[model samples]
Target: AERYKAANQRAVQLLEKCGTTQVEVDASGLLTYPIEKVDAGDQPDKKLKPLSVDEERFMRAFYEANVQEVCSAFEFPHKILATALQYFKRFYLQWLTCVYAACKIEENHVSAEEIGKGIKQDHHVILKYEMAVLQA
Candidate 1:
């Protein structure tokens, strides 16, 4: 709950500072650039509304179900699926932290996919280091 509040607050701060959270997407629906700032006159007032408690709960449940669905679809081992879900949770926390920090420093924003790529790189680095240690 506190984490959610912090995340939301950070988002609010970014939106206020930049006037918008608009990220450009290419024809393939992939983010091609950093977040773009909207003119003050063009910004929408309700763009950064926080979700209600019910909405938050629904979204959490939806994500959990989706994780399970993806695991089932791929026939992933239970242990691997559990690890993936744990990583998913941590990834969002790190992502929100990064977004807030970046916005403060550079007024830049990143798409979720970009954040995921970064997290994936970190995951690979950690795994490689761990394997090296085991082999030593």
Candidate 2:
């Protein structure tokens, strides 16, 4: 343990000497973003918009909870869970379809029928929604 610590210390010292330990300030504007304007989507002028930002967030959170529950029950891999969450946020898709899509994205390749049987859903629905999920 002592030798390991000494080796780590030497490595750190060498990093410092080479200026590799410097903390870089990200000056790229991409690192910064505008704060969300409060109730911006609640304005009356935007008639075509369905849900306001808060409403959408609430719905997304609810759906995400559902997805998490399903994923946990099925013991899915982390990548599938993450991708499902991304699909939830970006596409506002159904939790079942999101998981199905995430499985495809991660190359896990779970069949629609298997997922449907596991979840008590009709297999055809999964197949039907797969195209829509990928298109979005």
Candidate 3:
């Protein structure tokens, strides 16, 4: 509940000063679908058991740690950090490419070299994965 509230505040903040018609962060559509019909998410086998609450919490915490670490290294603003975290959690779950991909998604992309330096990783791997994603 608290996390949702925080996320809502951040979303509202992000929508500010943007020259769009959207005035508020409306999330009514997110709950319109029944869980049985949609919440399985990418799973082809609906018969597969769903994650327990503990498992879900653990997975979210694990990924969030990585998000924090990378965003901290980059010294990103609150918006970018939150946006990166959102992308990782909801869309692109690939930890290896989340940072660079998140930057690109937010329209504030940094150079691959800068991302490599920031994360202390070899730029070649970044290039390799980026190309793979682009090709796919």
TM-score per candidate, in order?
Answer: 0.46, 0.58, 0.46
Superior candidate under TM-score, 1 versus 2: 2
Task: Highest lDDT: give the candidate number.
Answer: 2
Decoy 2 TM-score against native: 0.58
Clashes of 3: 0
Pairing residues by index, what is the TM-score of model 3?
Answer: 0.46
RMSD of each: 12.9, 17.1, 13.2
lDDT of each: 0.46, 0.68, 0.58
What lDDT does candidate 3 reach at residue 62? Answer: 91
| Candidate 1: tens digits of C-alpha lDDT, residues 4-46 | 7777678667656666555443333354447665644464664
**Distance (Å) between predicted and true CA of 105, model 2?**
1.5
For candidate 2, lDDT tens digit of each residue in 55-80?
Answer: 65578779899889888888999889
How many clashes in each structure?
0, 0, 0
What is the alpha-carbon lDDT of model 2 when measured against the actual structure? 0.68
**Local accuracy of candidate 3 as per-residue lDDT tens digits, 2-113:** 7765665564454342212312111221212223333223434532443444566688889888888877877766777787676667643455466676677677768778
